[model samples]
Target: MSNPHPLQVERRGSGVPILCLHGHPGSGSAMAVFTEPLSTRYHTLAPDLRGYGQSQVQDPFEMADHIADLEALLDREGIEECLILGWSLGGILAMELALRNPQRYRGLILIGTAARPRGNYPPIPWWEYVNTGIAGLINGVKPGWQWNIDTFGTRSLFRRLLKQHTPTAYHYLAHAGTPAYLRTSRHAHRALNTALRQGYNRLADLPTLTMPCLMVAGADDINITAQSSQETAQTLPRCDWHCFPNTAHLFPWEVPNAMNETIHAWLRQQNL
Candidate 1:
């Protein structure tokens, strides 16, 4: 929690608090997809995760390190009550924080989120090495380097990914420090390996969480399979799951209006 580089956070609007959590391969600004729309009614607080965007980088690669940072940030900002919204990896961290300390938040909106990542199962972790090898090749980076972010994407991949996000997404992508997203992706894969080695699993912990939750999933997300989606839905004590038809993991960016309205409605419904 000392001088956390990835914990960079920004406040927006002037109403009920809404904490926006971004995904892996992203900084806090990734919430740019929702802020403009939500800020109209709800105050939005978006933070770059440790080692992602304008946030400070630090030691201890575990996600719990981030939970601590979030708690500290909230305390400092006098944000004692809020609605929690998280996408992708940020979703995982959100659930972890809520489970560990549910009193801090009023409710949750899970986007393309999961209670547990699919790992250490029928398929071995070897795929990570393969993908990292390929991703490294595509990124022209070897592990253990300082992670030059400029090489994060080739022109083709960048163009394709750019097509899926928004101008705000572009703003985040265009930031000079945003290149860290690529390295974070590579590093998260390795971190996932470390989590597996420690014998920790997301599934076994999901049912322990009793917080009120609303989960929104892309029908076509490759990152989180449909089966896992159902599992996440069932694990919660209070949850409403909505599967976005014909959408992928990038649906929030692809359909920002729909995502924004859905989230606003959820918050209003919960009165958070």
Candidate 2:
């Protein structure tokens, strides 16, 4: 395989390194909320995956490519080992990283994620379907979904899907109005489509993960159900699962203080 394009990273604080990975249609900025808090105690390194944010865009935006990009980033940083905290699609990539390089990570923190892509997505609401179709059509004409974000501002149709799952944090979690946001969204669309076609499933490999793992889920997350998180936790050899009541997909954003506290406590307990 060819080398992945260089990634742009946001580095903060200094201590045990924590590699933070963001979800689809988002850049390293998506994880910015946690960086400052995590930075106080640990070295937080958040990278914009290839073709996202300021990273170079390339072809074949698949999971493997994502994995390679991370590997290269770690190497570049001279980080032989670090803790990984991934959210949503980022969690899937974190798992893939552990599978490929088990010795390189100290532990895993998965938030609002599942062990695999759940094919049973509920039917799209009529209003959402119409708006999404319109957005897609417009985005198709203009490579990036910039027009959508520009026209709609903070209430862009692309981000509206998140509103259902992250009502409180929807606006707070909106993508920055930057060229990188548009570029990332365009690349993310391709990467997600490829991921769906590949049918990602890592259940069988979960038991092989011997490192300490923390699975955090939101009870009301409609995107990746709590049931999925529970099932994933059950599969892991060493896992601690926690579900926040009344919270949804963007629990970290919704309750950053609480989330950071929990994570700090967990890391201290693990001595990592």
Candidate 3:
């Protein structure tokens, strides 16, 4: 396979496109965040990046390659310039694309992303280990008080929210001895493999971007610290950095209301 394209894409609404790119360890299905709220106000596009979710696994996957796929995707969709919104890995890719081809993006939104030179942030030591970060996050999100689990500190909140992304989250979790729909953990290994073998470290090559930017960070985000988010916001010439004080790395899941308001405010800022 030369280079397969990403999976199904949905384009809705009718204004400057807001292209949403999701992070890894999950499908683009999480795009429901923007799709639900902003769909009526602006044209929204969300594609499962290669090897993620339902997208076809494209080899030689890297930030630059993903940028190419996104460019092609936009051209195919007739989007000249749009509000580029990316989360985590998606955010980093959006920054790269916007920096390389400034005209391609009307604005940029960095959610849990960083540009090394412009932002004093560290890339994940091993992209293959991305899932571990997510797992640790999921475990941490569990409401708790006793910090020492090793000292027999068991919080019951986890016993409840543990199933937040299960079944449909991962599908299949239940019963004394019965089973439901099984969840297939597909494409993860391929993506992680791509991460381990090929990683990105370039930062100084970035173009000075002047697009109206919105940097949303979860104040309690452990994966990508708040400092990193602010640093990224400062890099963009025009940025409005808003830190959700009570949110986590998975802020969309943790603070949907605030995220919605912030994006809505951005839409107003975009005059969309």
| lDDT against the true structure, each candidate | 0.66, 0.75, 0.60
Tell me the TM-score of each prediction against the true structure: 0.73, 0.82, 0.71
lDDT per residue for candidate 2 within 1-272, as digits (tens), equals 45766888999999999999987666787787778788988999999887777776646566678888899889989999999999888899999999998999999999889896453245555666566556545544543444464444224333433323232343343433233356574656787887778776789989989999999987777778888888998899998988888766767766767787888888989999
After superposition, candidate 2 runs with Cα above 4 Å error? 119-121, 129-171, 175-181
lDDT, candidate 1, 125-144, per-residue tens: 54444543344453343321
Give RMSD to native, each candidate.
Answer: 7.1, 5.6, 7.6
RMSD of 1: 7.1
- Models sorted by TM-score, best on top: 2, 1, 3
lDDT of 3 by residue, 114-143 (tens): 664122234434432544334334434442
Winning model by lDDT: 2
> What are the clash counts of all predictions, listed in order?
9, 0, 4
Off by over 4 Å in 1: 1-6, 58-60, 119-193, 196-200
lDDT of 1: 0.66
